[model samples]
Target: MGFFQLLMKKKELIPLVMFMTVAASGASSFAVYSLWKSDVIIDRKGNPEPWENVDPTVPQKLITINQQWKPIEELQQVRRATR
Candidate 1:
């Protein structure tokens, strides 16, 4: 028998098959929408920020290093002292 004939013979499973097909399609659509949404980045207020609104200045660091460069031993000592 053909696929359609098989389905027709198993009439009890028709609703379950239809429901699963619809659910899968819905889930796939939602997944596609989520992927498409990730491409868009929004601001704090859920709106897109204009280029003019963005600050170009450098931000201050929370932790500042007095010495520009130091040996690994000195750095390890400094880290241990902080702890």
Candidate 2:
């Protein structure tokens, strides 16, 4: 009954809605993959397999301590003499 009611008034829009839905769903997680083409629906390439294991390289914070201080951190403590 409910399904029939949905189809009753705007019958023409049904195809459009279905097409849009399909396109949306297809585009949700669709990947064109490496060396491929993409459109409304991506033309998938089955040639090369995807990277199974990703070797992530993390960069370490590199610091250099010079012997001389550049004025900023080298400021001497100020002394206030009491009268």
Candidate 3:
């Protein structure tokens, strides 16, 4: 069941739960994007320099989850079937 439906059943905690959910969603998404964003160093002319390298530990893909592979593989299969 969806969160809104769940909250509707509860009635009293609806506002509280919704507010918390919205705040949590915004905060987490923004915080995660900021943390993983490319930290390129710009020069005085507003050009990014090659010297500004991301740490080796930083991931190329923003998302940490490995579950995305399943869908990607499924898509490839679908594409082949359509040919």
Candidate 4:
């Protein structure tokens, strides 16, 4: 019999299959989160650079970009009028 057919005959395996799917998804998500939170940086020479060595101007540039992209007040007024 085909693998799917076997699964159809054994209904008890449904819960086990669901549990394994959830477990695998949770493990993968945790791995992605851990990588995102990691501050370790690799240099061009295959050396790890300390977080303190990162450029200080990067944060300042980000702040300037955010300030430049502020939302237009006209759009908010239009939305309020429509409501």
* Most lDDT-accurate candidate: 3
Better of 1 and 3 by TM-score: 1
lDDT (Cα, 0-100) at 80 in candidate 3: 88
Which rank order by lDDT, best down to worst? 3, 4, 1, 2
lDDT of 4 at 14: 83
Identify the runs in model 2 with alpha carbons over 4 angstroms from their true place. Answer: 1-7, 31-83
lDDT of 3: 0.66
- Model 4 shows how many backbone clashes? 0
lDDT of 2 by residue, 1-83 (tens): 68658767769878988898899877764543322322122323752423322222322113434434343332323212321
Q: Which residue pairs show backbone clashes in model 2?
A: none
In the range 1-83, model 1's lDDT, one tens digit per residue, is 98778889999888888999999999999776655342345554765544324333432233555635434788669868988
Model 3 clash count equals 0
Rate residue 9 of model 2 by lDDT: 77
Q: Which portions of model 1 miss their true places by more than 4 Å?
A: 39-83
Q: What is every candidate's alpha-carbon RMSD to the true fold?
A: 15.6, 20.7, 15.0, 15.8
Which sequence of candidate numbers ranks them by TM-score, best first? 4, 1, 3, 2
Deviation from native of the Cα of residue 56 in model 4, angstroms: 12
Model 1 Cα RMSD, 1 decimal = 15.6
TM-score of each: 0.44, 0.31, 0.35, 0.48
Compared with the true structure, all predictions reach lDDT values of 0.63, 0.46, 0.66, 0.64
Which runs in model 4 stand beyond 4 Å of their true positions? Answer: 40-47, 53-83
> Over 4 Å off in model 3, which ranges?
1-10, 40-83
